[model samples]
Target: MAWWAWLLVQSVVWCSAGVVAVLWWLWVTKPHVDIPGPPTLPIIGNALDFLEHPVTVNKIRDFHRQYGDLLRFYAGPKLVVLAAHPDDIQHVMVTSKIVERDPLTTSAMRSFVGDGLLTLNGSRWKTHRKLINPTFHSELHGNFLEAFHEGSLYLSELLATDSAGGAAPADVHAAAFSSAMRSFCIASIGVDPDRLIPDISKHEVSAVMRRIIVLMQTMMVRPWRRSLSLLRLSSEGRAILMYYAHLRKSVDEVIALRSAATEEGPAKMRRRLLETLVKPGGQTAIPLSEVQDELMTMAVTATDTTAMLMSYTLALLALHPDWQDAARRELKDVFGEGGDYLRSPSLAELASLRVLESIIKETLRLFPVVPMLPRILTEDIRLSGGRVLVPKGTILYVAPFLTHRLPQFFPDPLKFDPSRFLEGRSGEEHPCSYLPFGLGSRNCVGSQYARLEIKVFLATVLRRFRFLPHSRWEDLENSVLSITLHTFKPIEVYCVPLQESGL
Candidate 1:
């Protein structure tokens, strides 16, 4: 036995471990995509360039314009591939076994959203979808439609007040949008947020809504917090990683309150979303935790996204008064003097209101509710004549912002025309090209609710008043693509009361 022999063996072991660490570090930190980009730095990766612009979709467009359809970017240590072409998106969404929603994306969602069907995968997503599908069934759509109509009526009443002695233009986003959307959300989930949550202040709801946006920004900007994640250390670029922690705590409280309230039955139900979730199980029963997760996600999602759409739709309608007038004509033709806005119109009824639907489609086209959804690679696969090693965990992002604006799909990409959708599959190109609610098996569960909400709001608003854009119209545009595509500037418009306004 010799001391030198033991020391030599120890040194050899230490050297081998160093080599392995270096290789692992290289693999983890290196940019994996062959797609051309503006190069990168050492440890931080291509994060700096990606962050240069607030909208991720813009960077994706730049890359797509240069590299075409697919380009690679890294945020901290994670690799992301941006795809917008319909075929490419189809592959990622439909599955070739190479791409699905990545672990990190799932982790972030599960962290913020809990185990709502949105965050689940495979059997889990499918199972939840089956159980929850019936919730939207059983005449609930009609009920939610009625609720949406009520909220919309309340909104129209508020806007009518703003028309007081003819105010030239009003800031709808600042005044009407947030409040109206909050009301709609409350009604949709079948609860009044003003009364249920601990604080009953509008300012309080507004503040939390802002926090949700901030948390979403943090998710996009500082997506991967890396090694310090364990200690919960804030990295240089991590924009409010700590904020999400608190965000979750607040969500947990909401969850707790919801659980406690259910002991009393339907009358005690504080969330209409809860009504939808449990209404399906009926005598059978369902998981309240899962329902809570869906509710939490829907509350945040419903508030932010619906507000964004309402603002955008307002601006678009203002820009195209003809479409607004046409929709009004159609409404009058169908419902007459005593028609109910709350009732769910038949498929034919919805179909006949082609212009309204077109305007809605156009609004969604110009500014998608959520610009992009990130998918992950489940297995290795090939796309667009290239065999890229997708591995088991690569992120694939599909941007509706880019897809909707594609020149091939819609001519004069920037122009606002409701006729595009009015054409209705006749000479219309690319079915998968314009998906605002997402598509396939995992399409948004609340899409039916969302669409009905929009229609009801549009019906109530247009029936009563016409939106006249103030000077702020040009300034209010959706340039940011965070959790939802939204206008950085508040939209201000004049409320012009119609005969229906009782003015």
Candidate 2:
């Protein structure tokens, strides 16, 4: 053979050898877990499964039913293990070695949130968490009551206007999202939306946020699109970048306005979370870039998750009028039957809302806004009483959606029984089983704030209007697990004035 032909043959042989060597290495180091899941396709693994069914709650349930509590699958070449059993979840959640979130998901999130708490790992996350913790303290919650009340009132008015005095049905999610966004702006960012961006409406802001979140979710599940340079070349990626820029510009305006206001002296500054983060005393001052990222993270998480929680709770209450009546009775007892139903509940009064709280808890149990918590293993770990070995560098998904539905943890898990949470019933369950706000050191820090906001909104809405079932109320079960949980269609309900209902 000629020299050129010999050289080509040699290159082909070397390339083949290299590919075989890599395959051998992967096979030798792959996770030894004996868990069963849907058969994976070569290179792609079970990625097509996710692509076919992007909203994976039902599929996950099917897998848990077919396979046992612990199941293994893959996203592209990444080895993924889903831990549905409380024991396995506990092992993953509490283990110090499993501190890092899945890098692929984190990389996707970083485009929107930068190095904020949601995407950050290690000491940086620890520091930011410590600094932000005091802002959500119960003592400080009272400071946000005015904003929450105002937002609640705004929602009531919006609903009233949209429904034309109870003659029409309103999209509960949209209204709740608007209300939550308005409240988040005032309470967390210390800027009034009306004053800061007079040109922008709550609906506009909410729509932009929803688009951004949808884009982020898309990037998360489709790992191949995570490359920023490549993603920016696509239309969907460009739209997301535009949406993120729009959001960041708004937040940057707030930061600039708040920073200038801070110069006027401490007396002029209200005790808003942005103020605390911008000028966190005696600690390392958070960088401006980090502050922006943190605010963005707070904006998406606080508003979207809280809105979904409120929507789901209201929808469930509408389906179950007895529970609604029971919640109203509790509200009546706290605020009085003849008093102002629109009045804002004080922190103590909000705390007194046990029945309402139970209903909210049950709603979360049924539909956790963040269904799956993804983490990457830093060290090899044995689960299932040492029967299965999940190798280091493997991706682990501690699925609260699946774990919360386990028959062992929650009896008849599909049923929406608010009473299950009342009287300390939830305390009897495994610690890792109920993870609506997540568990362990890295759990959501804004959980208390979220609960407070949801309570205020629910109390205000329930007091003003009774939620009547809409034609699509049963569709709440059909949810899409985006960055946050969303239904296949917007959740709609008829809001009847309490006066008309003669409650």
Candidate 3:
């Protein structure tokens, strides 16, 4: 009605228009660096995708089918690019700029294991890598063969005691973890856990490992809980801190014992990796904290991982009796029917078991324990295949699970056939296709050790027992991703003692 009133209303309308215009400009032209990915809600991005599909392997696999090799999505506000193609994986892992681990993954891992080689980056990573590299050399693993033999014997006895008589099914994974942990203690810390640290059994370590798994799965699936403040408020998070404290204490005890032995006796008396790390010759001395971090990293990666692989391979063999019999025959050929295999076999003899190696390789292809290896690009990466733009600060995940199953790399990838790994077939495939131990400079350090442990444990167990599947293969297909891929329950198998099987 009044001229002044009209002017006031016009001012308010113009202010609102200016605000909307600025917002629109920011929304449309902010930055178009995002790669192809699933649809996202405003602000939330693709965080819900993890919640809907908790199993990250299947989620990445399904996304690859829908979005092709390279796809970008947000974990909370952070952008992550999933590189599924073998070429892209190779490029990211081997050729990418400043191939450091994603901050989220590194932070989470560090929270559990401290700043070990697995979590370190740049100069620190390089220094530690050089220091720790010699400890896992092929020659060093040979000294630990007796440990493997003893651990495998303990596992067999444990199974025998559990099954007692009459084809009773036992948890193969349980046995595998027990043996693997002891072997790790023996090889890494130079201590027989059963004799020195009776209480630090797989049962205890697994309880801690399970909690760590829950903490990781929770943080991954629920982006809201990924924050340090939020995680500290949760029970699983608190349990993780407590577990780490306990782990540090136990590791310290082992280190102290090793140190005393090394100090009191000649250097020749000490052969374990811990001795080398504790009293490194001609290398920079590693800090106790750093040693603990590396030890924890090895304990988690080498022990349960190799154990799980052994269990999965055995389960697969159980499901396919032909392969089981074939592997057993190969074992017999190499070890000569319980001659030295039960006590100790040299690395050369172990490597001679080609069929068993093939089976393990195939199992790793199908059920890669560390299914998704993640790296963060410090700068923009134009992928090799499609020249996909993975922007700087972008987290790239190399999904071996998806790439391993691609028909291009692996024919009939679902089929549990070890023949594909029998030399010529797998050698013909892309090198990046099989990355159960990851790729590039930052690939798993204990890979050689892991392979040796698997071969030794498998040969020992298969020699003494015949594993029969307790569940259908289809049921076993469902796996939970927690740093490593694992079945929801312990994989059960009928452990028929070789004498009873009459093979």
lDDT of 2 by residue, 1-503 (tens): 99999999999999999997886566555555687889877656777777764554566677789988888987655788888888888788775447789886788889778889989989999888888887787766777888889889988998887777778887777788778878888888777777644344555555655555666667877766566566478775565566567678887787667555535355632355787776533221588889889988987787778877877887788889999999988888888765465566898999989999999998888889888888989888989977888888988888888877777777887888888889776433787888998887788898888888889988888888888877444588676666677776667778888862227
For candidate 2, the TM-score is: 0.89
Give the alpha carbon lDDT tens digit for every residue of 1-503 in model 1.
Answer: 59999999999999999977775697575646566555666555676775554554455566668876667776555677777777777776765633245555556556567886757777767776776666555356656665665667666665666557347555454444445555554555445545444332333344344444544555556655322254344342233344344445544554455555535354532324554455432321346677667766665666667767777888777777787778878877766656353343554565577778888888898889788877776665566656555445667778788888878888888888888777664234776788999987667777777777777777667777877766344554535556676555555566787664222
Alpha-carbon shift of residue 83 in model 3 (angstroms): 1.0
Per-residue lDDT for 130 in model 1?
77
List residue ranges in candidate 2 displaced over 4 A.
Answer: 1-29, 95-97, 197-211, 227-242, 262-271, 279-284, 426-428, 471-474, 500-502
Tens-digit lDDT string for candidate 3 (1-503) = 69999999999999999977775554444334546788875445666777654464555667788887677786545677777788887777776634688877777777667888878999989988887777887667766787788888888887787667526777666677778878888887777676543354445555556566656766655645665555567776665566567667777777766565534345453345676677533231677788878888877777778767876887899899999989877766766644354446678888788888889889988888888887888877788464556677777778877777888778878999899977657534776777888877888888888888888888888878878778667645667766787776667778888762225
Which candidate model has the greater TM-score, 1 or 3?
3
**Could you give the candidate ranking by TM-score, starting with the highest?**
2, 3, 1
- Evaluated at residue 158, the lDDT of candidate 1 is 59
**lDDT values for all models:** 0.63, 0.78, 0.73
* Alpha-carbon shift of residue 5 in model 3 (angstroms): 30
C-alpha RMSD for every candidate: 6.3, 3.4, 5.5
Better of 2 and 3 by lDDT: 2
